[model samples]
Target: MFKLGLLIILAAIVVCAQSIPFLEESNTVAECLASNNITQAEFQELIERSSEEDDLENTERRYKCFVHCLAKKGNLLDSNGYLDVEKIDQIEPLTEDLREVLYDCKKMHDDEQYLCEYAFKMVTCLTDNLEQSDEVTEAEKNTNKLNE
Candidate 1:
């Protein structure tokens, strides 16, 4: 949950979304990865380096692709733009509404149009679409704060 939240926060840096508090409050890549007992500072450095040369749009796309690559390889997310709830359940079971949003976001996301903007864009949509009763997850709450 927090990993994906961190992804959106990191993505805001490439896109420079100032209105959102996510960027300000999120854990650094180094800190966030520690929670999972993973160590890969080089990955964050690589992503930062990739952002240095491109325009915002292209850089955003690169970041999305970078995230997509990680999620795909790690099996944390599916190509349909849904979080792998089963895999997440292996760690801990999530609420039903969180599951609904995951599937709904999967159906709503368009990889062709967004080109793998699932971490940020899809989560944003999911949070916005879910009502208060849906019991949005922590990641969804963070993502919902994204403006436009």
Candidate 2:
């Protein structure tokens, strides 16, 4: 019984170790940007412009345009009310990177008895970025200014 418990613990450790790499790579791109570990020149430009704009609504429109431009460059499209894509082509080469990371993470989970940490990190990173955009920030500012 002790040996069985030890084996289970060891299996869990191995799974966690393997998943670390997958989460590291897959979550790096967006997490870094959101955390400012990755410098986002495009987002900066939009944010700066939004800062200068007189009207929040117009600022938001421009910010949305900037996001659409970025998405075009990234070859990504709106999917499943989320980030879903009909084909990998929508994301260009980065699609392959995402796929590779996801596969590695899932392989680790299935063979090494890991859990879906990568999926959690990936979703969190994406959501964080989506929420931190200039439009959202400006909207918040507008709300605060109105309340005051």
Candidate 3:
């Protein structure tokens, strides 16, 4: 309920239709990390440092990669390696949508056709591979047997 609403808001914020507020609002690495969610602070700091370089295009490219890496790692609701089941539940919908946004950002940043194609393939592979992991397979088999 409340969690679902929070996820909807987060998805709206992350979508291509919406801008990344962290880039627009934050002035420092700390600020950016705080704004995006402290769970991603380390990666945000890395992006901030990369942006200090003179090349704006390079900065954007790196930032896109940073976002992709964050998404690949998982949702932002948990912190300090402790899973807050409540927070995790709250952000599940947003995390799912973030995966899509990260994939798109990776595609846009990948100038070389090879990297773009590779990333697209990687997206498919990660999603399918994750779904077929042992735990998920066992759960699915249990469900199928139950239904039968």
TM-score of 1: 0.41
Estimate every model's Cα lDDT from 0 to 1. Answer: 0.48, 0.35, 0.37
State how far residue 142 of model 1 sits from its true place (Å).
20
Off by over 4 Å in 1: 1-7, 10-59, 79-82, 110-115, 118-120, 127-148
- True-structure RMSD, every candidate: 11.6, 20.4, 15.4
Query: What's the lDDT for candidate 2?
Result: 0.35
Least accurate stretch of 10 residues (summed lDDT) in model 3?
1-10
lDDT of 1 by residue, 1-148 (tens): 2243344444443222221343245444344345434446544564455534333334335445554443443445545654565765453465676576666766766444554565556545554555344455665777878743
lDDT, residue 148, model 1: 36
**Distance from true position, residue 87, model 3, in Å?**
24
Q: Write the per-residue lDDT of candidate 2 for residues 103-133, one digit (tens) a residue.
A: 4443443332111233222333333333355
Give candidate 1's whole-model lDDT: 0.48
Q: In model 2, which runs have C-alpha deviations exceeding 4 angstroms?
A: 1-59, 78-83, 86-125, 129-148
Clashing pairs in 3: none
